[model samples]
Target: MTALHWKLVIDAADPHAQADFWARALGYTVEDNGAFIERLLAAGHAPAELTVEAHGRRAWRDLAAVRHPDDPYEEATGIGHGRRLLFQRVPEAKTAKNRLHIDVHAGPARDRAAEVARLESLGASVLRDVDEPGGRWTVMADPEGNEFCVQ
Candidate 1:
């Protein structure tokens, strides 16, 4: 079987906070894997150095995730089976433009201008607005500076 299971992994300085922002922006839910964490702690299988207290709860300080609202998820561990974004802490800041970026498909019913307006209200900023003979799209950045597009 193929080994792929995750949709996307985001690098962040503060993973838990980033996960929270993204969850609200996308109308998604943050995964609550505290049960699994607690179990590991209780069984003495988890290293004490790997856990942290976040938002008055036990959490992994290095990584956190959020999932699409309609996706199927495991109730026990709170991991989703559909589109999800995982954020992991990293020391280095983003130093260059993203070689790989996401395209927001708001559908044909909504054009780029309207989408841009909506996204801007949701904490996205327009990096550039490009119009070419082939098509048009707005280059935008998420709240944390990750770039994406509205097409």
Candidate 2:
């Protein structure tokens, strides 16, 4: 079969921290590729400089990922099959607003007001609230300033 997968790769100053924050915020599980790392190290395929001790375990410092809680994951590697967000280390800060953004659909049952309140409690700040003829939504920024919408 042809390869087909969807993942969002985010550039972060601290990939592990980002992964941790996202894992908590989205109720996701952080991927633990420690087994693969150990295998590479044992085989001399991974350079010492590429590894670091994080959370008392060997991890790749440059990249980490978090996946949705209900998604199917590989137990050995802790990689998931669906709705994954990969965070990769970068040296620079986010200089501008995102050209693309994520929207969290809390559903009409929750109502926008309650959802916004809940998100605020989870460390999100309201950026703006829009009311249009078709519909309305509230824009919010995550702890690291990534923008998302609640509708």
Candidate 3:
């Protein structure tokens, strides 16, 4: 049997932009594929049209990804093999609510209000506040309207 690895794939209008936002929001680092991309291009294996200048380096035009700082990554490719979120460029804009969303646990040692405020400062907009018997959480949307919760 083969091992299976997975990453959360998101659709975005501007993949690099979304990657940047989520990277800061989650305290993750954007995967740098500059060396690998350059190798592919220079070797005539990949077309220049598939790449773009992002973060002052070459990146896939349709894809960008972020990963936890502590995770292991391929040194040659700068690709994280664990706990990664990949944003891929989509042709259409988001027109409906997300069927699945991310829930952020700010931790029992952390202040919920402070965490929510911090996320807002990073470009998340509060959709609403929810207070229930179970616990309290804030519904928020990212820059491109992807919804998530903060608790």
The best candidate in terms of TM-score: 3
**Tens-place lDDT digits, model 3, residues 45-137:** 999999999999999999999999999999999999899999999999999999989899899899989998999998899999999999899
- For model 3 the local lDDT of residue 79 reads 95
Give one digit per residue, the lDDT tens place, for model 2 in 1-151.
9889889998888888778877876778888888889988999998979877777788998998999988898887777889999989888888899988878887757777887887788778999999999789999987778888988
Candidate 3: residue pairs that collide: none
CA lDDT, every model vs. true structure: 0.84, 0.85, 0.95
lDDT of 3: 0.95
Model 1 misplacement above 4 A? 1-4, 47-49, 53-56, 108-111
- Among residues 3 or more apart in sequence or in different chains, the pairs in candidate 2 whose N, CA or C atoms overlap within 3 Å are none
Global lDDT of model 2: 0.85
Which ranking of candidates, highest TM-score first?
Answer: 3, 2, 1
Error of 1 at 79 (Å): 1.6
TM-score of each: 0.82, 0.85, 0.95
- In model 1, what lDDT does residue 96 have? 85
